[model samples]
Target: MKVGIAGLGTMGRVHAEAYRRMGANLVAVYDANPDRLAGFAAEFDVEAAASYELLLRQVDVVDVCTPTFTHLEMAETAFALGVDVILEKPLALTVEQGEQIIRAAREAGRRLFVAMVVRFFPQYRRAAELVRAGELGRVSVVRLKRVGFLPAAGWFRDPEKSGGMPVDLMIHDLDYARWLLGEPVSVMARRSPALSGQALEHVQALLAFPGGEMALVEGGWAYPPGYFRTGFDIAGDKGLIEWSSDQPEPLRTLFPKDEPPPALGLPMAGLEEDPYELELRHALAALESGGPFEVTPEDALAALKLALAVRESAASGRVVEVA
Candidate 1:
């Protein structure tokens, strides 16, 4: 498949590398910043499209790696041209825009894959698989944490652009929680005040699921520069599964004496391929085989709704009912 990347930023470069690794035809790339676009094109040996429109015309798929605010417009254009799209997370700044993108794709009859890379991470994928297979029978509680240093990009600090930390960062775990459990019935959240003249923020959200399942999801940009951490804890009637980035082991499981733990092979530390690359490969494979994407456009919209609810709950100091 011929692929063209939009937005020559960190994620844009990542997608380009993944496509190269997968041996896809990377025909073109575009960026608002000419210097970055030229540099990326030179580095990847791909054509630098004069504009997003030219890039759309050049490839079968357009990878929208631009900011959250730019997703809907770029996706709509690609869909209108009967080209598939791979959109980055938080699909859009608002649910309405996300729905519009979905509608455009439906009308265009093109595949719309949302890049929710968390779903591709080895440990997270294993946990979800085990939950679905009933290895973690009747799951009651899940705890997820994804905290890291503030992004160097100034746009990430702007609420209008990135939707703050909850919508931008926490949405990963929020989406994962929904994928593992189900749609959250309600969400209650708290966020640390953005310090004066500082962009750092933190949020902790409690999601109540329909079957009495609960998820404590937290994310932030309060860590020191270059610091990052993530982990998960899932508890159920039959067993418990845990994984932390700080731990030497990738995952740990405990089961009752009568119940044997499910067999799981861990990826070698520092040797596993990047989850972003895996996610892109899966998306392209689905596109080629006409299979379902791991993260559907509707799934992306649902995650956006939940993220918006988290923001609302944090601002209102009240539990927000998720529709």
Candidate 2:
């Protein structure tokens, strides 16, 4: 299958490399800036499209790697041109825009897969398995923390393109929390008051779920000077499962053993595959089989809904009901 990559940013480049590594055809790439796609084109033997229209005409699948603000246009254009889409996280700048993209895809009978890459991470997969299998036993509380150095000050600091850390970064953990626990009925969040004359920096969200499961997600640019870290700890009646995204082992406690944890295959890769390569393989497999990718537009919508609810809660200082 021919895949066209749009937006030759860091993620675009990473995904393009992944597609190439998976042996999928990277037929064309489109980026508004020629310089952005230059290195990626050189690294991977894919032709860079001077315009998005050219890229859409050249490939059957388009990965919308641009920022959230631009997703709707590319997604609509691609679907209109009979090209399926692989949209980056936080599908669009706003829920209304994301909803419109989903609507267009359904009307066009096109598939839209959101790149919530963490779902494909082996550690997260295993954690989900444990939760589903009841090995964790009656999940009580889930706390996901993503605290690290912020991305370079660009659209990231701006609430328009990047959508702040709540939508840009924390949306992952928020979605995972919703997936692990049931859908949140309401959320309350507190932000660290707009800092440095910029957008809000740190955010803490409390989610109330059915079946007595509650989750707390904290995401921010607040990290100790120098290092970066992201991890989640889940607690249940039977035991607790902790996977530090950067650590070498799975942290677990069964209340009977004090031994060191088991070695968990790196989450960056799959059980026996690199995560990015696995993403490529899955996308290819799904496309060939005429099936939906692992992450559906609904899943992306859920993540976005949760993220927006958190933002509303933070901004209004009241519990915002999630739909």
Index of the highest-lDDT prediction: 1
Give candidate 1 misplaced runs (Cα > 4 Å): 263-271
Per-residue lDDT of model 1, residues 1-323, tens digit only? 89999988889888888888888889999999999999899999999999999899989998999998888889999988879999888889998898898998988898899999999988888788788888878999999999999999989989899988888998899999989888999999998988898878888999998888899999999999999999999999889999999998767888888865576444456437689889998998999999988788888889989999999998888999999
RMSD of each: 1.7, 3.0
Q: Report the number of the highest-TM-score candidate.
A: 1
lDDT tens readout by residue for model 2, 1-323: 78899988888878877886777888988888878677677778778787999989998899888888888888999999999988889898788998999999999988888888878777777888777877666898999988776676478877878877889989999989977886888899998876677554788999998676789999888765566677888888767778776877744434336544334322533365567777667877887898767778888888998898888888898989887
Off-target runs (Cα >4 Å) in candidate 2 are 224-226, 250-272
Where does the lowest 10-residue lDDT sum fall in candidate 1?
Answer: 262-271
What are the lDDT scores of the predictions, listed in order? 0.89, 0.82
lDDT of 1 at 92: 93
